[model samples]
Target: MTKVQKGKLISGLSVGKKLTVMVLVMLIPFSLITVFLLYTLNRFGNSYNLVVSNVAIANQYNLEFREEYDSVLYQMVARSITKDMINEELGLTNPDDMTENVRQSFDKLVTSSTSQNARKSAESVLKLLTTLDNRCNDINNNIIKGGAYDVNMSALDNDIRVITELIQERISEYIYYEAGSMELIRSAMEAERIKLIRAIGMFFIFFFIFVLFLVIYLSSAITHEVDILVGEVKSEQINSRNLELKLLQSQINPHFLYNTLDNIVWLSEGGRKDDVTGIVTSLSRFFRTTLSGGLDYITIKQEISHIESYLQIQRFRYRDILNYEIDIPEEFLGYRIIKMTLQPVVENALYHGIKNKRGGGTIKISMHHQGGDLEIDVEDNGIGMNSEDTANLQRLADGLEKAREDNAGFGMANVGERMRLNYGPEYGLKIESEYGKGTIVKILFPKENSN
Candidate 1:
């Protein structure tokens, strides 16, 4: 593949890899949350099912116990009747004695039962049997021995009915209590099931939203940075082209240099030492500054001094027609700026704005602080540009050709390229002008102290 195509492919691959890694990072927590939610939901479902089954089993046990209790009551009544018949056959007459005898016999019957529940049932039966036995004995004794009906057998019958009714009522109460307990358990289980469902739904909704947001954020952040990198690469390619042009331009025209130096030498030989000395000194200084390459950054103070030196040479060449002023804040002298940044803009002001005028105009340079940025303005009250010229200026500022055949100034394009290379596109030169009025070129930079 061609080198350009290879560069594009590599850039795409790198960005894709970063996106994949970021997606994985975002998904990890979401995956864990999903697993935890599912596990918790499974546990809750199992617990709900278990509780429901337990309640059903408890209900069945309650029914069985109620039936058993009723059977025990029936057996108790039957045993009481049998005991009364036996006591009557034996002719037991005294109430106290008969009671004692029946109580002892009933205790024995209770002991004979096979199960503990049966034995407990027998105790209640025995109490009833003893009452009936005593009543029968009293009736027999009253009839045979000619005493009044002393024991009140009807009252004993009523007492037996009351006891039976009490047992039935107790059974009914137990049934009611058991039914209420089952209902409570069912209600609790239903509430818990609803709560668990709601909790699981909310967890899924929130987790989904969080994961979605994270994915979007990661995608946006990675894509924006990649775009910036791509732009920087494109800018670097353009700068490479410009560097090639500059290198080619550095080669000297020997004939022109020889002629200029010969004139200065002849003037010195003719006893014009002061003029020759000044010209030679300016030439030396200019050549020295131009050849001092490989340095990219310098203080604003140094840049201003370099501009002043260049302006001094220009003034000697053009006489007093050109006047310039540089107004900079004292505190900003220490701030670092790109080398040759201001020199190019200043050159543009002098060449395009004041060079062709009948009488040259003033060039004003001012620097100040505004909020978190430094503002530098190069204003020239010379032959200003019209609307079309302003449009061309804007195109040139964006590193595009506008009226390139005219070759308005070399420095405008150079300064714009340097600004974009150093601080990105947001900060650069902004030019404002009106026909025959004036031109103002502003350079915006981030405040060094703020940085």
Candidate 2:
């Protein structure tokens, strides 16, 4: 029972054990009552049958006594000397036969009778029958010796009548006692039936109420816990997204800066002072705007400035091989965008597109408004991708591809996921590429002013 309490004890039990306890709690009482009730009913049936049989036996004993007594009285009054009468009395001449008859009758009485008093009274009646039978034999012998008239059978007749009345009284008492005992047993059976019904009914009512509360308690507890878990998961996801965004914003592209510094060193060795100054200044401005005071979102104007610095450095390094253009309307420059959104696309064009082409190519950055949505496209006329490579790039940008040590795919995927998380799924990166011709990447988001 202690295991059923809502605590560590109940949690320790398995599902099967809990169900077993519940079944036993209700079933054991019912089983006990059923067994006891059946036993009582069986006892009542046996008693009822015994009483009926004993009553029938008593009636038959009375009838047999009356027939034998009347026959002897008629014979003695008429002075008859019938052979059948002499033979009937001669049968009682053997004391063993008389004793055997009494024994058999008493045995039947003992076997069938339920009450001790009833058995004792039946025993007395059997003894009286035996005595009366013996007396008749004496009267029969006297008649046989001196004839029925000289026998003086009045004494025998009176004796037989008195004994018959006594036997009748005893049988009546035995039957009355048996009837009373049967009535008492029946009353007890009725009481037990009522008690069983009440006990079982009360147990079931309490069990039902307990089960109702258990269901309600368990349901409420589980539902409340599940709701709390979901809330925590959502909160964690938002925090993780913000942390990742900050980490990405603080990251400076070491490879690009390293190559630019190497180019600056080469130019310094060649005595190109003005070119070194221009590259160093652009690199400074690029890193400054990329950090953006550690904020996740920045104005459209700042977004353009960072990408312009990046393009300038690249153009200085490539000289006559690489060219680029930016055509964002002034009216849209005050609007907001996620920081570092365009720079990664511009980087992808430089490394994967324009860098791969033999003659290099032009990279174009443009912006337009369609309905309430703002769209920015980065198009490159360089060595673009085939269908498979385009699909692979899309997978990387969507974060379906796992990151490896040397992979540069995280930048595009991070920017796409950030926009989606901030605004919704409707705003993210979309890619269109044609094999060996060009590639265009479009970024879409709702038009909102900088705050």
Candidate 3:
């Protein structure tokens, strides 16, 4: 019942925050693509290097292995070269040393080769080299034991020559199989590279589309919120302007101002200086509060003064039958309300309620708190309407029914409209009346502090 903080409430992210979110959203996909691309490139580079290096090492041995081992063996068997000459000519002519060199190359292959076929072929070549070493050992043993030339030559042909030829064939087989594997690996890597590139293209396209969707969604949402805020502000301003116009229109009414001026002239002709002074003073206060310096709102105290001034002028006009009492608490007087709200309702009471009765009755104004609302009731002991008429008046105030020809409740209807327009539909006029008793017009307002 104390204060109200009023405005249209909208929920969403701010523009700065929205942009930051969009940037982060966009960066996520881009970052993923960057990391994936780097990882794929590095993976492909390592695979290609491993395969190319294996092929190069295998090629180096393919031709040289057979030439070096076979030439030295043949020259030694034919007696065309001695051990010293072979050693001088070839730094590694010994069967053990020659086989060790090939085994070392096989060591590299076994350690680095990923293909099972290539590893198996390398193992086969190494076994063949071991067999050749055994053959060389047998030939050497026979020569040391003073074996015959014919037997040594036969052993070279049947054992050493055949084994060396087999070894050569095995090495060639390894190179052949390894070369084919290298081609397969290269094809696979090329295919994977193409697939990864296509995946990246698709992901980038999805990222672009998602970002565009967010931009559109956020832009439309912001525009909608702005539109609501603008519409509410414009509606509030129009309501205030309408209320001000009604107040000005009331001021120019011939029955209201012209009659009051005539009352002042009559008071002067009768030499009633006190009456003239009082009416003139009340009229001045009424007009001043009506304009209220073009402000939309006034304090409860100012509204009280305005209504009191209007009643005073009326009291002079209907001095015999018009009397009013205000019973609002002092604590509630500082609260703000729309200007000229109560005056029109009180004027309507004077014209329709009090004037219709045999003799006008006193209008009592009272204010009290009802839950979170401030309720101001203007009660009049006039010829009150039946329940049906009161219901009709309530309907008209709610704008659910058309206007009546009598125009009996037009002022109060306008008052209700102004209240609902400024505050809300739930805060407006509530009418209660009984056929034989009295009518009380309650105006509801959401409580608010002035300052």
Candidate 4:
């Protein structure tokens, strides 16, 4: 739907793009944190309920175990008493041995039952078992030896009952302690869940506020720059046509014109009227085309003719030092270009590249229509430039701030600026050069924008 959704806004987009990126970055972490917090809160709430339920279950189980242990202890005591009666009736000689066996069996049962509960419960059970064992030993000794006939059986029964009560009390105490601790844990978890929810809410609010501030600041900055650029473009459109006219008029060198006129006058006085007439006719045609600023746009054929006239005048000046040629498709003759645009690039190749060579060089100009663009190239096999000279030429295309003392030139800057004004920034001069080889100047314009 949008460039950001397609991932194309990451690098190439403007300030608005940055806002989208920031929002995305903040939202991912925010969503993750929100999900984690909700999960934790839900888990904690469930765990607290589970712990409460388990505490209740443990209490019920402990009560049942305590009741069962009490019944088993009572039965063990009854069995011990019955064994003493048998020993007395049989006149057993080793009653102590039988008593010890019974004590051992009772201890093992008590230990196994108490292992399920806490420390207090186990200690209480052990104490109860030890007391019962002592009572059994006393019964065996008294009945077998027929001594202590006045012993109280009620005291022994009361002692066993008291031990059973103590064991139950210990179990109750443990259940109470565990339940209290679980309640405390549930309270703490509830408080922590509340705090986390608040923190997440505050984080979202802060994130939204920061995004709002950033978007406002970026919008203002981008709008200001765009407005300034629009104004500059409007100003250029208003002034460019007049500037092109002035440049065309200034193309002719006044001193050269005067000298040529003098030569024609001298030739007329010497009876070489035919040669004088030919020079006059060429000069007249050249000035007429150069000064005609009525039409701001003209066909490629017309611009090429204008350049031919300019080159002929230069050829008269540097007769053998410069050679020129042009090749254009017949179909492209009707295609239009800004007036006087192509000629200046060729002039730059002559003055900057070939004029300084000793043996002179050939200048070849060619043009053709590509798919959606026009390609024009001016190449010369003259004294080519070094890397630094090429860089300097590039700077001149933007308008020379400071003239180079070594290689002073003018046509490159004027031609480049005119091209930019006429056909946007894309259409301009591109220079390629290599030292001791040659130089090529290329001009590109849109085919759709032609006449």
Specify the highest-lDDT model's number: 3
lDDT of 3 at 99: 80
Give a tens-digit lDDT track for model 4, residues 33-89. Answer: 657655764665454454344344434434553354344333334444434344454
Candidate 3's TM-score reads: 0.44
Better structure of 1 and 2 per lDDT: 2
- The digit string of per-residue lDDT tens for model 1 on 220-240 reads 563465345335434433432
Clashing pairs in model 2, backbone N/Cα/C closer than 3 A: none
* C-alpha lDDT of candidate 1 relative to the true structure: 0.54
Task: Please list the residue runs of candidate 4 whose C-alpha ends up more than 4 Å from where it truly belongs after superposition.
Answer: 1-251, 266-271, 399-407
Please identify which of the two predictions, 2 or 4, would achieve the higher lDDT against the true structure.
2
**Candidate 1 vs candidate 4: which has greater TM-score?**
4
Please provide, for model 2 over 107-135, each residue's C-alpha lDDT reduced to its tens digit, 9 standing for 90 to 100.
69866787888787777777766766665
lDDT value, residue 335 of candidate 3: 90
Give the better candidate number (1 or 3) by TM-score. 3
Give the least accurate 10-residue stretch of model 1, judged by summed lDDT. Answer: 242-251
Question: In model 4, what lDDT does residue 405 have?
Answer: 21
Show where candidate 2 strays beyond 4 Å: 1-250, 449-451
Residues forming the 10-long window of minimal summed lDDT in candidate 2: 239-248
